[model samples]
Structure formats: C-alpha cells, structure tokens
Target chain A: MRLIGKEEIENIAIGAALLGTGGGGDPYIGKLMAIQAVEENGPIRLLSLDEVPDDALIVPSAMMGAPTVMVEKIPSGHEALAAFKSLKDFLGQEIYATMPIEAGGVNSLLPLALAAQIGLPVIDADGMGRAFPELQMVTFYLEGASATPMVLSDEKGNSLLLNTIDSVWAERIARSVTVEMGGSVMNAIYPMEGHFVKKASIKNILTLEEEIGRTVREAMKQNINPIEDVLELVGGTALFEGKVTDINRRTEGGFAKGTATIDGLNKNKGSDCRLHFQNEHLLCEVDGKVRCVTPDLIAVVDSETGMPITTEGLRYGARCTVIGIPCDEKWRTEKGIATAGPRYFGYDTDFTPIEQLNAKAGITK
Target chain B: MRLIGKEEIENIAIGAALLGTGGGGDPYIGKLMAIQAVEENGPIRLLSLDEVPDDALIVPSAMMGAPTVMVEKIPSGHEALAAFKSLKDFLGQEIYATMPIEAGGVNSLLPLALAAQIGLPVIDADGMGRAFPELQMVTFYLEGASATPMVLSDEKGNSLLLNTIDSVWAERIARSVTVEMGGSVMNAIYPMEGHFVKKASIKNILTLEEEIGRTVREAMKQNINPIEDVLELVGGTALFEGKVTDINRRTEGGFAKGTATIDGLNKNKGSDCRLHFQNEHLLCEVDGKVRCVTPDLIAVVDSETGMPITTEGLRYGARCTVIGIPCDEKWRTEKGIATAGPRYFGYDTDFTPIEQLNAKAGITK
Candidate 1:
C-alpha cells in the first residue's frame, strides 16, 4: 500500500482526464476536492489489488450523471460518504476499501477524496481503465461482476439502493433516476470481494494515471512536448493532430452527447477527424474513414502542454492532438463487444482494433 | 380485525374505481388478482386502525405508472410480494400489516392481494381516502409522513429501495424510475408506524369502499338507480349527467394526462363540461366555469349502472354521470391545497369544496 498525497492527487487528476477521453467530468473540481480532503484528513492510503484479502469487501464510489450538470452542481462531499455508508449498512459488512468504477476526471479522484475523508484505503484499480458512458461498459461487467446492490445519494439527502436484474437494467434505471435527481448523484456500486476485484478490475489504473500526469507535468517543466511520452505510456497511437473546427453538443437522457470536428494539421493536413461521444469519446473517423471505435480509448490533449481536454473543454480554434489506446483485453471479447461495441451505440462500423486500422492507413510514428 | 374474502375483493374493486377519481387503473384486473389470491390463501385479515399497536410497522403498497400502460402490462403478483419482502428485509422488522397509499382501482386491491399472499394483515386505512395522481398528493404527506424508505419492485425481479428527504422528492425519483421499469411497477411506499398511520391516514377507507360497493351492488340487484345512493353514501354531488363527446389524452411523463369534454344531458342539456386529469381528475368545468376542483374527487361513471370508468376507459359517445365528493377535512388544510389542489395540477381555479360548488349550481339530491 502507498500513500496518495496532494501531489498524487494532482497527477492522478491530470492522468484521469487524459484517460477519461473527453468525458468523466472536469478534473479541476475533483482536484480541488481531493486537495481539500487531503489537507484536512492527511494522505489517503491506496492499496494495490494484491494487498486486499480474498474475503474483503470492496465498493467503488463515483459520481453518475451528465458532466454538464455536474459542472453546475458540484457535489457537497456528504453525498459520497452517505452513499458508501448506506451501501455498507445494507450489506452489513465493513468495506475494506473503495475504488473508482472508471478512470475519469471526477470519478478517478472522487474515490481518493472519499477514502481520505472516511479513512479507508483506495484500491489502485478501476472497473474501466478509461471512461465509458454507460455503467455496463466496465471490465468488471465484462467479467460478470454485478453492478448492484448499488446505492445512489443526492446532495439533498435522498438516496436509493438499487438491486437490478442486470447491469443494463441498472444503467437504464439509474441513468433515468440520475436525470431526475438533479442530473447528478454520488454512487457506491459494484460491491465485490477482493478476489473478484483482482479478477475483474483493470489493475494499477491509478498508478498509470499518476505516471501519465507526472510525465505531462515533467515534460512541460523541461519545455518539451509530452505527446510522444503520453502516447507511449498508454501504448496508444497519435491518431490525428488538429485544430478544433466545430462541435455539436446536447445534454440528453443524463448524458452529454455530441461530436467534435477537428481540422488536421501537419502530417494529417488533408484529413479532417470527427470525434463522436456520449460523455466519453466513443468513435473517431478520419475523412469519413473509421479510425477508432468504442472498446477503444480516444483522448484529446493540448499539443504543446500535453494536458488532456475534456469533451466540455473542447473549443473552436484550440490546437489539439488526438490519441487512441487499445482497451483492456476483456473488452475485446465477444460479450464485451456485444455489450458496448459500435452497434450498441448505433454506429454502422464493425469492431476493428485501432492499431490494425492505423497499420492499414500506413500512419506510424 | 375482519376477514376479507373474494366477495369483499369484488366489492372493494368497484368502490376503489369510484374513489380513484377516473384515474388509478382498471378495477377488473385488480378484482381478478385479489379474487385469485383469496381462492388460494383463504381470506385476507383486515385490521382497523384501533387494532394496530402504536409501534407496529404499516407499509402501504400500490402500483405506479400510467393507467394506459397498466392496461397493457399487468403486473405479475410476484412484484408486490417482492416489494413488500424487500422493504421488510431492509427495515429488518416484521411489517405488521400493509395498507393502500391511495384508494384507487389497482392500488387499494393490491394491498389486499399482497396481504393474502404473504399471510400479513391488511389495514383498512389509506393515505388518500380518494386517489390523486402524484405520490405526494396524500393526507399522510400533509401530516408529514415520509414516502420512503420505500421499495419498488418490477415483475422482472428488480427492486429499488428509496429514502428521500421528503415526499415530493420521493414522487419525483420514484416516478422516473417507474417509467424506466417498464412504465408500471409495484411500490411499497409511505412506511409508517401504527401511531403515525392512525394520525396520517384517512381511516377506514377500505371499509368505506366496501360499503360503497355493497350499496351499488344491492341497488343494482333490486333494479334501483345506484347514483343517488352512491352520492349520499360518500356525501358527494351529482355534478353533471352527460355523454362523452370528446377525449384528448396522451400518456406522458409516466402519467395519463388529458381532458374529456362532455355534452350535458337532461337538466344540463344546454351546457358542456370539461373534465381535466393527470392520472386522477383534478378539475371540472361546466359552461366554462369551475365547478369541482381537486383535492375534491371527480369521478365518471356509467349513467345506467353507476360503474366507475377510469380515465383510460373514457370513450366518445358514452353516456356518463360525473360526481364530485368532498375530500377529507385534512385535505381542506392550506398545506393540503398547496400540495394537490387544482392550482398544483396547473388548473387556474382555486380549490372550492364540492358541496359549495353544488350549492352554487343548485345541484342537490
């Protein structure tokens, strides 16, 4: 186990935003919340997957709702504590630790803040190595971990404990309820034993986020571009370098759904890339050719600073570099593809690995 | 306590439909479900408010969704049992008896059916003596009874336990979740102790329903018109005798919302009446003037047989009689009016007692 202090939170926030793939929520708010929590409660303890016992119960905590709504209605911190306590009370078991359901801006750091405040260790793992919009788009879900008994607590002291038949139903009901509960709520979900955690979770996600954050920060300090290091760290391909030309966004059904159009620069000058997203970037196309799709991670970072930009942060005329990382092997399975593949999101394209698409296009570093 | 048999089930269904105020659900379905349960489980024991101990827990069970949806998707008896059992498990206390949250076609009978299945007693009390649309539109809410910790269960083995700061939030969240759960789900809501039940509930609502049912049945058997007797029984007014000329309805936001226009017949031949509803009839206007408004109950029944017709059952060219009943004294309070009056339902008229409106129009038995 290692201690997650202010520096780790800062780095994790930056890395989480990078992996968040233009969704999750703003890292700035999560960063401030985590910093304040650490200042008041000291460093948070983070346990690796192997450190937890097989019988120990682990619950992942995060915020669920449209990132746009989250921007206006920041959580009051009490919500997370209430959700965890409610779930713990319902299970009648002591939670060994808390973790992130997905690695995203607010989601990844919220657990650290919660762990610090409640004096519990955070598992250095997450259900998704990168953010996905729906609840079932997690590696744990692909590995058959139940997404309930999940507790959702709003800022106004209302809470719901949902026990659904499947993760899909959980997503449907919880998403609608989230929209009703002022468009956002804190969730304590996917309670699993440590053994299941080891089996289902994407291990060392927090550590990876920290490493990405540190890489970006250090590279910036030395006045060098960090895009190559960031891409290499995630085993990702620099898909396109561009200036954002247009964006179409709408907050619907508790999700920030939209697309960003990027005008390619330098090597990709003739090709314009379109990034489609429902909260997180789900698809990427270069000049009308599929480059990357969901079950793959797509991130947009400042070309110079290499700091990640969320979907909400995308602006006209902003110079950015887009990267695509292969998802965890679990998501490549047939069931995972069926669960969150292009078809599920109403895309016409079939599942194809990002590297294969890049190789076909003869685009290499 | 009294034993409720199949005969009582039949009678309660008729009365529940009447008190449902042209909303709730169809009585025929609830009648069949309750009768079947009685055949299998013998009889359901119904306890009076006086019989319940002060500390005894009393949960009210009902179905939430548009009546139109309920007509198509009948709940399997398992949903109510699941909801009650889930709530019982959550509270960790043996629920003494179950009651109805509102007196409606399906809601009033659902508790009886559940009681029989679980071998739990039924309480003769209900939160609303007559049904209203929203969850918070109950006398219990005015008395400050919480609408949760409540459980909602769908036929597909999914359940949610909600705890809200107030009844309004409970209605908001539960309504959205109900829509997500296939537009209709069984709810175990407004859990209260016996003392609070007595204080908050409209007492002996089931008993009154049975009496209304018996009066109508006996009158029908003797070939006497049941309209006058029904009105006298409930201290209600015969507001209009008419034929349904038009109905404008759309099921939206988990509610059957619309208005029915009736062309007056007999003494009211020259006038036209408009009946407005959101699940339950909230307003009635005769010749473009407000006649009866909610928290008062407005019900439409067959002019020949006096059988109540649900909002969904309202049809064009059907000869009908519209009656208005004075609400419980508790509902005449300021808080009650603000919670469920005509204004609350978006009608411009102020809440006037049905008796006052009847006197003003010179409509008397």
Candidate 2:
C-alpha cells in the first residue's frame, strides 16, 4: 500500500461510507478530520501489514466511547496522537506504524489522522472487516490478543494508562475514564508486532475501505449512481431503496439498540423493511424475509447525495437506500455467522447469506 | 481466601445463579462441572491477590462465546484445562492459581473447576463483578493485561495458539475458532503476575459469588424467598415483580440481544415493565420511568422459584422478579456511565438508580 492523495481520501471516505452500511457514524466529520490531518501534516504512508518489518511495534489508533457522544463532543484532535506518544514514552521504544482497527466512519479515518500527524503509515488492514460496537468485540480479543497497555486520552488532555488483567477490564476501566472525560476519547491500543498482525488481521482492509470509499466518490463525481458504483467495487448487490417510515428505538443494553421500520419506496414500496441496529445495523429484514445480516455491511445512504447516515442518525423521515454488501470471505464461514450473523445478535434464525436472501427475494437484479 | 469446601461450592452456584439475574446461563451445569472436578481432584485452595507471591503466575480462566451456545454445547470438560495447560506450557511456568474473569453463570464457576482439577488455588477476586459478553470487556484488559498468546482448544483436541496484535483480534480470532468448534469454548487468558492481579481484580468475588449464591440456596431451603436473600447479600433492592407478557428477540450482533416485556403482578399489577437485555439486562423500565440501568446489575429472577433465567430463556407467561444491585464504585463515575448507561446503550434519558425508581413507584415496601 502507498500514500493516498487528497482526492483519494475523499473518495475513500465516500467508499468507506457506503461500506459503513449506515452505521459507522457520519462520514463528513471523519472526512474533515482526515483531510485536516493530511493538510496539516502531509500525506501519511499507508503500509500493507505484510510490508512492515517483524520487529516493528505497531499500535492501532482510533476513538472509543459512544458514537452518539462523538457527534456531540468533537474530538480535540490531540487525543489519538497524545495516546500514541504517551505509550511510546511509557514503553521506551520508537513506534513503527499505525492502522485502523476497523474501517468504519470516524475510526476508519481516525488512524489516517493519527498516522499523518505522527509521521507513521496507516496499515492496509483492520482487525475486523467491518464495524462493531465494543472494543473487545474485535477478532483480536477472541484470539487472545491484548487491548491493554492501552491508553485512553480524553479531550481534556487527561490520559489514563490501563494494564488490566483482561479485555473486559479495559472496557470497564476505559468506559469510566471516557465518561468522566465526556463520553468520547481517543485510544492507542492492540500494540503488537507484524507477526501477530499477519496471523490475525483481516489483510488489506484499509485498502479495501479505500477502494470502496473511493469508488463511491468517483461514481458520484462522474454523475454515476453510488449504489451501482459500490457494487462494481466489491461485487456487492443493492438490496433495497426505501424511505424511513417508522423507527422504534430504545437505548437498551448499554447500546443504541432498536428496530427501524422502513417503507419500501422507489421500487421497494408495497413492502416493508426492518433494520435492527445496535450502534450499527445488524440485521435488515425485508418483506418478511431476512435480507442482510451482520458481519456483512448494511449501509444506508442518501439516495441522491450518496452521503451515509449512521444508525444513531436514523430518523423517521430520512430518505435512504439500504445496500447489502458481502463482507470478506472470512465473515461468511460458520465462524462468521457465529460472530456476525443475525443469530449472533440474538435472533433465532439460520445463518443466511445476503446472496441467498437476495435470490430468494428477487432483489438481486 | 482458601479453598471453599464442596458445600460452599454448591451454595455459591445457587447464589451466583440468583445474582446472574436471569441471563448468565445455567449454573447447574457449571456447578456440576465444578463439583465433578472437585470430586475428581479433591479440592482447590483459594487465594486472595494479597496472598499470591510476587513471582506467582496467575491466569484468569472463563468460557468465551455466547451463553446461549454454551447452554446448548456442553463443554467436554477439558477445554479450560487444555487452555490453562497450554498457557502454562507457553511461558514454561507453573500457574500458581486460577481466577474467574467475571462472576456470573458458567464462567464464574469455571475457574473453580479448573483449579480443583489442577489442584491450583482459586482466586477470590475477578475482573468484573458481573458477566459481560465480550472477552476484552474486562478491567484487566484496560490495565495493560494481555489476552494474547491465548490457546483456544476445541473438542476435537484441535488447539490453536493465537498471538494477535490486539485484544480485538483476540475476540475476532477466538470467536471464529469458537464458531468452528461450535459457538462455545473455554479460554484461559490474561496470564499475569500476582502484583497485577492485586491492582486489577475485584478481590473475593468467588467468595462474594458463593455467599450470594449460598444465600439464595439457604433461603430457599428454609422456604425464604431468594430475592429477599439476595437483597441481604448485596444491599440490593427489589425493583419489580411480574410475569413476562412478551419477548422480542433478534440475534444480529453475535449476541442474543432483545427485550422482555413483563406484566406487573403480585405486589403490583395493571402496569407494564420492559427489561432490555443484551447478554445482560441493560435497562429496566417500569411503567414509564427508568427503574434500573446498565453498569448497575438489572437482573431478573423467577418469582416463585427465584431461579434466574437468561434473557434468551425468557418467555411470555413466565413469572419474574426484577432486582437492581449496585456495581463496582468505579462504574458509578461519569466515565462508567458513558461506558454502561441507558444513554451509553442509546437511550436519551438520564440514569435513575433502582432504589430511587422503586421509591418513586412506591415499590419500596
């Protein structure tokens, strides 16, 4: 992977927005943050995880805490860099590079900012292929990776270093510090060598995110349909386009988890679709059939502007198009379903692929 | 803390089940597993973090994956032992003792089983006072603990040692392996020094769980209500009593997340209660006010049996009593709220403690 230019960042944001599947949070802020970082610090090196030397100490950087809070509490832009720098001092070692743990919304663009400012390259991969709510929900923790020696930096410039005995503790302690700091904080964690990254990371995800994000931008700039452009980039299928009719959401389970009922419009009318989101859309049900389930992206985009809206941003009157995109093959196996399927989210349903569901619904056209 | 007797182990399961508040899964199986291990290997010594020698190697052990799956897939009884032994061998050190990562359901008693089986002492403390879904959601993970170099073993005796770059990968890679191994696996992680445990652990949790679990058992044996017994054990408050009238569940985020609507009965009726759960009860709304919220334990128990049923186990027509207990003081901070409040979960309302809500609703009696 190489450095992406200014135009490419905008394209990547657009593509990442579509891939965000309507839950990575507002991309505009992330785009602005990334663009600012690039402008101020110069182009960041986007390194492939494979290209990094084995001895290179890599740290994943991003924001943590409630995304809803992120919208309200704009980052100070110093938290991520501060966290990374503090860890370097604490560990008494020069840092090698950085990467996004997941390529979604602010997090996707966050590392770009951090790496640009710190003069390191963002890796072309992430721990998770898509977005998730919790820090420990990443593939790394399940494989027994560390979230620790983690530093959470609040906007107030207060930094807390945690060396918990487990990942849950990291979340537990970080949550308190984050809330105390105002519900949003920047974090530098999952510090590991290239060997571990190669063993566990979903390779080239940053590149994939960049490709997907870029495709959306280029398509729109050229007067092309974003959904169609996105499909070509990832071989994704446009599942449905609808108007948000009703959203019955309740902040439950320490997450913004609820169901949004959408009126099928513009070819999806006469049919109803339901989106189940917990900070992100986990399940998209259409016409009484399971359409798109998690681990796969379920981004909701503005039908015209092609901008993305997060699950938190979902409203009753929002006109949107629901797109179902296939995740990497790693997310399709039985293990994928176990980690990202509808059942994994609590629905007692069989693991059905988006491709199969589209075929069943005749929506694959 | 020393080894709890076989009698205490039995009692602890009962109390732990009650404290589980209807979502930690069957302690029956965990108890049986612990009992069998204790019977087979005699007894385990219990140790306080303070008692652990500075050089002693301590590894926290628990089941990592879905509780719903754990109920379905009976562990082959050797997974934890395998993970522990693997980890023990990896560092080439004798593990001085074992500890529970969290104190709920099967995971609570898991380390007890391992400790007794290996003749290692059980630590009285745990990472979290209650159960959470993710592996990296622990206080230890926040405090620079490593979940990596973890060994995940399947029943087929296929073991993979993972050294991910971060905690998220641990969750990711382990969840994938678990999905392949059948959605449930035992993991021994966060191998740390005794000094780390002292700083990170909520000490005497097994003792706490046992006392709590035992209180429920003894009260029931004496024909006393388990809820009342629980209240006494932890200075808890009874939030509500009712019969489940509806359950809306969907598994979308690799977690069995949903809501259970309970009809107020017994002491109160003609009112509605909604308890939202994602692995654990995140919110408890009685009538229209928020009665109990996350970070604080909002558990449900059977009205008659007092046995706690998991969120997935809830069904219409089942009678339940809602209990609200305080969480660790650290969770009471603003940061804690950001990590685990109704707002954290996506609700717009502020948190109101169960006691205050109970007082408001005249349920204080």
Candidate 3:
C-alpha cells in the first residue's frame, strides 16, 4: 500500500471534486471526515485487491439514500462501523478489510476515513467505478453477493440489522428507511471473502483516485491538461473537446437521470453529441454512433481547464470536453458488457472499445 | 406437488388480480400466457419448499421492467423459456423446480406458466410475496442470492446471461436491456436450491393467491362485501371507505410516485386520509397518523365492485375503500420493518400490526 500523509486528503478531495464534474455532492465533507479518520488512526492503508487474501473478510461501505437528503440528515457517522460491527457480531468474526462501493464523489473519500479510523486496510478497488443510486447496484450484486444482514444507522443513533432474502428488498426497505430517517444514512454491506472483492472490484481504485486526484492537481500546477493526465493514468484518452450546450435533468428511478448535449469546439462546430447519465454517464454518443460506454470511463470535463463534470452536474452552456478512458481489461469482456456496457445502459449498440470508437471517427491518437 | 388446472388459473387470476391493488399491472396477459403454457405442457405442479430435496434447483421466473412497458412490448412468450434454457446450458444442468418472485398481479401467474411449460413444479412461495418493479427488491436478494448468472430474454430472440458482481448491477444492466429491447421482457433469476426457497419464501402463496382471488370473486357474486372478503383472506380488516378528492402524481426515480387524498366515508366522513404510492400503495395516513405502509398490503379498491385502483390509475372523485392486510409475517420481523415498514417508507410512525391498528380504531374483524 502506498503511504499518503495528511495533505493527501485535501488533494484527493480536490481531485475527486474535479472528477465529480459538478455533482457527487460536496467532497469537503468526505475530505474532512477522511482527514479526521486518518489523523485519529494514522494513514489509511490502501492495498490493491490483488494484495488481499482470498479468504479475508472484505466489506464495502458507503452512504445510501437521497444524496440531497444526506446534507440535511447528518449520518450517525458510526452507522457504517455499527453496521459493520453488527455483521461481524452476527457472523462471529472480525473484518479483515474495507473497500469503497463507488470510486467517485463522497464515496471515493469515505472509505479512506473508514479504513483509517477502523484500522482496516481499504482495497483500492470499487464496484461500479462510479456512483449509482440504489444499494444493490454494485458489481458484487450481479455476481450473487448479498447486501443483506446489512446494518442501517440514522443520525439519532437508531440502528437496525436486516437479513432479507434479496438485495432489491434490502434496497426497498433501506430506501424507505432513508426516507424516514430524513433521506440519508450510513450503511456497510456486501460482506464477502476477499476473493470475491478481487474478482469483482476494479482493483486499486483508491490509489487510482489518489493518483487521479494528484495527477490532475499536479498537471494543473504544471499547466498540463488534467483530462489527458487522468486519461493517461487510467489508460484513457480524450474523445472530444467541446462546449456544453444543453442539459436536461429529472430525478427519476431513484437517480438524477438526464442528458447533456455538447457542441464540438476545437475542430468541429455546429455538430452536437449527447451524453446520457444515470448517476453516472452510461453512454456517450456523438453524431449518433456510440462513442463510449461502460466499462470504459466517459468523463465530461472543462474544455478550457480540463476539470471533471459529474453525472448530475452537466449544465447548459458549460464548455467541456469528453474523455474516454479504458476500464480494466475485464470490463471489455462479454461478461463486462453484459454487466456494464451500452446495452446494459439501454443503448442498442454493441460494446465497442473507446479506442476503436475514436479510431472509427478518424481521430488521431 | 398440488395440481392446479385450467379452471384454477381462471379463478386464481381473478383473485390475484384483485389482491394486486392496481399496481401489480393487469393479470390478463399473464393469465392468458400462463394458461397457454399450462395447456401446451400440463397443469403446473405446486409444491411446498419442503417437498423438494436440498439440492433441487429452484429458480424464480419474472417479468422485468416497467408495467407500462410490459403492456406494449408483450413477451414473445419465449423469453422466460429462453432465459431458463440459457441458465441450464450455462450450468450444464437441468432445472428441477421454479418459483415466482412475488405474489401480485402478473407475477403470481407467470411462474406457473413457466413451470408448467418447462415441466417443473412451481414452489408455492416467492421472495417478496408482493409485486415490486426492480430485480433487487426481492427478499431473496437479501438472502445473499445473486440475480446474475440469471438469464434475460428479450422478444427479439436475444437471450443474455448476466453474471454480475452484484444484484444492483443486475438491475442496471437488465434495465438497460429492457429499455434497449424497447422496455419489458421476461427473466428467470435468483437461482437457488430448494432449501433456501423454503427458508426465505412466503409459504403457500399460490394457494393463498388462489384463495384471495376466489374469496373476492365469490364475494362479488354472493352479494357480500368484496373488501370484507379480501380482509378476511389475510385476517385483515377495512380501514376506511372513501372518495378520492385529489391526486398528485409525478414520476420520480423511475417510479410512479404520488399522493391521493381521500374523503373519508361513513363513520369517518368529513375527515380525510392521504394515500402515498410509488408503483404500489405504500402508505395510508388518515387524519395524519401513518396508518399503513409497505410489507402491509394496502389496497385501494372500488367500493362496489372491489376492483383495485393502482398508483398510476388513481383519479380524483373516484369512489374507493382502503383496506389494510398484514403482509406476510416475514415482514413483521425487525428485519422486515427495517425493509418494508412505515418508517422504511419515510413515515415517522412506529409499526402497528394491522389488527392492532384496527382494534385501536374500534373496528372489529
């Protein structure tokens, strides 16, 4: 695990902030909490999933419910630990490690805090590689992991443990609890052996987030395009340099789902591209052929500054560039597409590599 | 396994249809398809979970996607079988049994059809024991079951196998498939052994559905109160009969969520009750106490004919009666309340058993 000091929290938060694109909620809270956790318990140990023992207990921790409600209903903070502890008590075992559920936004920084404070090393990998609504939306769920025997805690310190028959019911019940708890709370779930984590997670995402954060900031200081820096770090590349022209949004299906329209700027003009999002950019199509889709990273950023724009933050008239970065080799597989591709996001297109999409468009590498 | 024939399907559909309470979508298509499947194969065998061996393969058959979409893009009637076949081929094993994911509307009957045609027995239980849209909302999801390795078949003859890392990802990918397939498709998921089915499922739901269906139908013909008959089926009672005075609806989070204002009838006249829905009747707050919630079946039916008024169908000035039935006892546990109680649904009230709630109101069974 790479060692990071006190200042890294702010740096990572800023990097996460940039990648957040506009939503992902204020990274400040996660930053503060993480920093505190780190300060209290020393630096978080960030290990690649590959470093994890196959039989080690690994749990993903995060906040579930309306993010809008999260600000108002301050979490018990202990909810994650409480839930984690309860599960441990139930299983009569101790947790060996922790991991983030999503690698972007508040979630990205949260586990750093959890790991530092709880004295458990956090895996650098994540489930979706991005934020998504619903507790069961993790990659682990698709692989048959349980979100049940989960612990839910409110700000007032009320805690409940559930052992449901399925993840969806966990979501439904948890959603109801979130609403009742005033819309946001803390949760720890998807407890499984480290082997599952290694198999499912995009390994070393925490370090990647830190590097992504550090790279963007360092590049900014050196006047390098942070987008390119991010692309390079994550094996990604720029898809298009453009100005955000229009944004349409509605909170639907438990997510802020919307479309961001971008007008080509550098070489092309009057041509438009559409980016569809559901808490995460699922599909990005330019002039109607799929340009990029998951399990590749499609990040919209500032065309001028190379700052990231989150799924919920796409706005009309914001100058931006869309970048396509490759996910791990696994996401490009048939299993990957079946789980996180364009078709998975409702696009009629087949899964195409971002590089291929760029090549098809005659864009120079 | 108990044998249910053609007449039983007709009878059960009518009863389950009534119990569906509008949000379950119409049972007409499900009944027709199920009847055809049963006719083509044979009467479906109904079995208790205990009737099967521990190793007996039990998979749940369901319709995935929006109810509105289901009506338009009717299954090619091949999707379920195709999905089942995919799983069977993937595992190189034959399935021994089948079950429904829920016991409401089309869900209750569709599995019977699948089971009959596939020459498998239908377990008289389901994960949810009620209709909910998303795949992860099932109790089985909580039981550490994965929806992936599950099969999804579209009308276009595309049978996709998803072996995701988690259940939530299953929904995301499946949802995208549904949208790409033009929304609505059949799926077979939550593959498990019979032992898990017995432990998790609400036992005898098929017979219960049949009885619930029959009780309401016979009540209508016998000139008895259909609402009363429904209440009797689950040891429930009438909360209040009323006229809907107002309805406010908007689709949020991919769900039809809204509120209905009912003018209390008879003894409670001049007072009003508010019913909230998100795909289904989630709660009923009369004169401001959170009266009923999810897990407890709250159905708003026509006063005279006893037809359920669904969330999407609630209209101003509609005459109706609101009935509250205790959900499957599984829902009453702490895990259940945490998963589906009023508090879970965003209400501040503590859970009160329906009978107790009735008794408090001075209403007798």
TM-score-superior candidate, 1 or 3: 1
The parts of candidate 2 lying over 4 Å away from their true place are: A89-92, A266-270, A333-336, A362-365, B1-365
Residue B125 lDDT (model 3): 81
Best DockQ among the predictions, by candidate number = 1
lDDT (Cα, tens digit) per residue for candidate 3, span B108-200 = 888888777767888878787676666776777766677766776677665555545567666765666556555677787888887787787
Please name the candidate that would achieve the greatest lDDT relative to the true structure.
1
- TM-score, one value per model: 0.95, 0.51, 0.53
Candidate 2 docking class:
incorrect
Model 2 Cα lDDT, one tens digit per residue, A1-365: 67766777776676666566666666777888888988998888888777888888889987887777887877766777678877786567888888888767788888887787778887888877778766776767656687887877776555655555566656655665565566788989888888888777878776776676666666667877666666676676666677898888887756777888888776543378888888788888878778888877787877776666778778888888877777776666665566566776787777677788778876655
Candidate 3, superposed: residue stretches over 4 Å from native: A1-365, B142-144, B164-169, B268-270, B348-350
Q: Worst ten-residue run, lDDT, model 2 chain B?
A: B156-165
Q: Which stretches of candidate 1 lie over 4 Å from their true place?
A: A248-255, A268-271, A287-289, A363-365, B250-253, B268-272, B287-289, B362-365
Docking class of 1: high
At residue A23, candidate 2 shows an lDDT of: 60
DockQ of every predicted complex: 0.88, 0.02, 0.03
User: Residue B261, candidate 2: how far off, in angstroms?
Assistant: 42
How many angstroms is residue A25 displaced in model 1 relative to the true structure, after the best TM-score fit? Answer: 1.7
Interface RMSD of each: 0.5, 15.0, 15.7
**Ranking according to TM-score, highest score first:** 1, 3, 2
Q: In candidate 2 chain A, what residue range of length 10 has the lowest lDDT sum?
A: A156-165
